[model samples]
Target: MTIERAVPAFAGFMILLSVALTHWVSPYFVWLTVFVGANLFQFAFTKFCPAALVFKVTELKSAGQS
Candidate 1:
């Protein structure tokens, strides 16, 4: 998927994973959901996402070469 799609997809996946972890693993996993939400919140104003950056650096290198 494109960066536009992948970022949100990744964020959603993290949120779900965090919730599952919180349920079966530990409450500390809720912090992960909080972190992802906060990053999305800041990205709204800053337009800078670390996940997107990582995706760019790693994903582009591998996928774009195809």
Candidate 2:
């Protein structure tokens, strides 16, 4: 998958994994999930995701047009 797609996919997977951890492992993990979710939400709203930036950099380095 392209870096553009991978960033959000990884973020989503991490959020889901965090949720699962919170449910099956420890409640503290819920905070971690919340932290990730908040960042994603902020990115969605502000259009300034760090993940997206990283993806863009990787894409540029790889000579991939994003």
Candidate 3:
């Protein structure tokens, strides 16, 4: 998938996975959800996402970059 799609898919998957881990694994997993949320919040202002960077390096095109 393109970076534009993968980014949000990754975020959503992480959020769900963290929640599941928190419920079935450990309470500490909640921190992962918080971290993901924080990163998403930061990206709104910074316009930078580490996942996006990784996706770029892997040659996943952005929405319009194709």
CA lDDT scores, all candidates in order: 0.89, 0.78, 0.94
The digit string of per-residue lDDT tens for model 3 on 1-66 reads 789799999999999999999999999999999999999999999989998998889998878875
RMSD of 1: 3.4
Task: Please give, for residues 1-66, the per-residue lDDT of candidate 1 as tens digits.
Answer: 677778999999999999999999999999999999999999999999999898897664433554
- For each candidate, what TM-score against the reference? 0.86, 0.69, 0.92
Tell me, by TM-score, which candidate is best: 3
Kindly list the per-residue Cα lDDT of model 2 for residues 1-66, writing each as its tens digit: 676577678888989999899899999998988888898889778877777677777653323753
Q: Which residue pairs collide, candidate 1?
A: none
lDDT of 2 at 37: 84
RMSD of 3: 0.9
Task: Output the lDDT of residue 48, model 3.
Answer: 91
lDDT of 2: 0.78
